[model samples]
Target: MSALPRPARTAGRIFAWTVAGLLLLAVVIAVWVGVRGALAYQHLQRIQTGAAQSTAALAADPSSAAPTLARLAADASEAHQLTSDPVWALASHTPWIGPQLAAFGTVAAASDELLRESLLPLATAAQNVSIDGLRPVGGRLDTSVLAGLVTPAQDAATRAADAAVAVQDIDRTPLIGVVGTAVDRADDLFSSVSTAVDTLSRTSRLLPDMLGRNGPRTYLVLVQNNAEWRSLGGIAGAAVVLRADDGRLSLIGALSSGDLPRGFTNPVVALPDEVTKIYDTKPARYFQNLTQIPDFTVDAPIAREMYRLKTGTDVDGVLAIDPVVLSYLLQTTGPVALPSGDALSADNAIPLLLNEVYLRYAKPADQDAFFAGAAGAVFQALADGRGSASGLISALTRAGEEHRLLAWSAHADEQAIIDGTVVAGQLPVTDAHTARFGVFLNDGTGSKMSYYIDPDVSLAWGSCRPGGQSAPRQLTLQLTLTSRAPADAATTLPEYITGGGVYGTAPGAAEVVGNIYLPQGFELVSATATNGAGFAGGVHEGRRVLTFGIDLTPGASTGVTVTVRANTAAGDAQAVVTPTADAARAPVVVATCGAG
Candidate 1:
């Protein structure tokens, strides 16, 4: 109340200042402790999240799941080992950025809600982009606020980022060093994932260049039944995409049912480690030495693979996307334009055809909220397939219903020569395998397509073995199809298949015609297609080709001879027709008469 003496006042001032300093010191200590805790927590969270994500991103089969875990583990080891050495002020050099980021759960959760509200479209679009055989990109990893934490971490991220490089030296096990270089460069762990993506984007195509047959025509293709494919034929460069609550997508890294890259014998790393700690626990434990599904050069341009081994081999196209993405895409555009010059409207085709995105921008309508639950089911299916097949089947069915427009032809039954039917086995051939589909068309008419299958193709212990190995055996086939439906030959014949197979048109594909690679040197020797009332066989080279004649007419018969030229009279004029009679019923039909 009354004025105090200067000496007394000074004493009080000292006491107050001292208390203030003590409190400030305590706050600083609290923040430091908090940040470090966060870092540890972050590492753990990442491990947990990563594992769950890996599981969610794959098929239930071990063949599908194992490689995913290994790749993710490897990638994580690399991420953890990456070190950043930004030039920061000595006074400001903080080591707790990683730790503070550990606390991102606080602000990030709130920001996520806001982000999510604005991200519905982004999430939807992200799904479609992935389905269309492209990677899902552009979103905060529920990590934006974590980035904010970094800004306040007093150069903590900078130091930790740099240290991360040093940590990478040990990252390599008997076979290591993925992130060591990244860390050694003092790279920021915080930005490593994003940076890697940027790096790959600029340096080269994720997969090989979109080369032609020179490179395997690696287009993206998704499978409804991974097991069936493996049992039948296997695959190459196969990857699957899944969605997150935050509107971002995490790739379930996997190799194709085909071959692993050179020096990568163990595609699926089973050991778990500190790096694996950044993902979901069990799944992380399951896949500790992985990061991403490698983008293989399933398909490439002729020029790109000109000098590479096995030139003139390529994937037809990529088939990617899960049921959720399919549902969303089908729900959005209503129908899509396929390379076949048709409009696809069925939702089922969404799963099969999402890979061939020629030239187009993303439209917001591609996402469907209904797909979320089913998508999660798919993730669960991958993680706990043995525990939950019903759930997976439901997810597959629901999603298929959402976009089941394209009914890809399947070789259901062939009484004479069983070729592709998994049920009608021929020494356990693969169910199906392909990267991208090489779409070919002739307007309203059929097309001349060369479907590139995996090179290491073969069948297993099935009686109808067609010359294969324990490994897959692939072959290149060139097919030529002509249109029927005289009305503009440009209106219906190829229209239905193109529309359904490539564009997602309703009622699915009218017919998908192509020759299964026989390596038998068979040529279109003759044709009865021209004799069909109101139809004519198409032409190619300088000869009138017939195989791709008017598609099968209901209750009618059409035949085209493929001359095998006796391979020498000793070879027994022996020949095997691809896509036997039953194959005619496939979503992509290539057969003679009353087939599918």
Candidate 2:
């Protein structure tokens, strides 16, 4: 081409250079966003890992939890800063991946808050607690050391509750798929933490008084004999007066049920009308009959009152523990040597106390003496600090979770903390919102056959409709009982353990009163035994209850199936069983209905 104008050529060159510069800028921005997103994701992964490790470590060794928690707090704070960076915020407005980035940012912020405001403070406070001082030296605890922990422990508990509320309010649903399994895990961790915090808060408020902050507090400790089963757990065959003065626990007195007077006319607390209708009103006639009422809330107060009438000393609270709980304690204390040259270890405690005692001591008097000795030995070991505090705490936690250890306080304020806990041992009130069931067993044979009884529970739901439709959903609960006695149980077992015609049942036969407590919204459709027998159904505490009698011989088995229909939608269902001498491995089946 000919030589064009110089001005036009200059303008074309400038426009070309401007286009190249703009492309370069776009590439630089894209690289920056990508790198920042990757870093944020990496930080999130670290936070998840650290949180899990910290939780496990804390549970494993609560005495040394502060270090792991502090590290976790630092990591979480860094993640929060990284996710909240300006780069991430700008990327959050970008197309397609914007929602993911925003969800991650929310999770990061919540995690940071939980670690810094809740876990760190609680762990730091825990570090200051001296569990060793709670131990008794020469049968006396230094109350001053325990008293010192009250303030820090209470402060930590308050912070934990606040953190729990914060975590509960955060919305983590949007972060589920974006963060893979970490989001679900975090949700579960937070839920468990919330529950723990709530418990800690309650414990903090009650611990001071329970440890005798006001004055000396006396508790009636009922050693439930699971071998002779009752509605709540077992018959209260042996009891001890436990006095706590500023956290120093001492066994004041011990007595067997036979030693208590019978048929006390005076009532400490009036029995609930429902209790009178279901169980007899005369719960104080015999010490063993105190737990005839299925609910321990009813049983515990009655037991306390009965103790007062007999001992003439008012108890501030009542605590019930079965042999299973004792075994758990033995695990922490290693073993206890009784005065009779017999040693009770964790492995042998349950069997020795539950079964072998019946065999070794044919007379009830000898059995009582053995139990008293064993109890004293274990208590003395605990007082002497032979057990690890962490182990003891874990053991008690497990027992409480299984409902083997129960407590009820006479004080209204103290009892309020225990009212809704599993250890409170109360039946559920009428509520359409939740599903609850109970499988309770009472020894109709009036013998020690319960030691050989094995129970299995299976639950399943059918035709469940969501969204509160009045659909009739079926819930089936089948309980199978097997007698684990030896083939020659009739001859090998003691006469007293083999029924002995105590409750008008056949000799060598195990008779059980099986009660199935249904939910509030459920109606009993049918209840049948394995032998085609029918069950008697009634209403107690606004819930349908089915009662049946089961009799099994040695090496025999029987089962009862209870079916109920309800208008409620299906959700998570739970069954509370009467704790036995050993924990039962019950199979749980969950079935949900409705189209996706």
Clashes of each: 139, 0
| Model 2 stretches astray by more than 4 angstroms | 1-63, 77-110, 142-184, 262-269, 428-434, 463-475, 523-526, 563-570, 583-596
On TM-score, the candidate that comes out on top is: 2
Give one digit per residue, the lDDT tens place, for model 2 in 168-282. Answer: 3333323334453444455556656655655655665677788687789998888888898887778888877788886777888888887787556655577666656565565
Q: Any runs in candidate 1 off by more than 4 Å, and if so which? A: 1-376, 384-518, 521-524, 530-557, 568-596
lDDT of 1: 0.27
- Report, for every candidate in turn, its global Cα lDDT versus the true structure: 0.27, 0.72
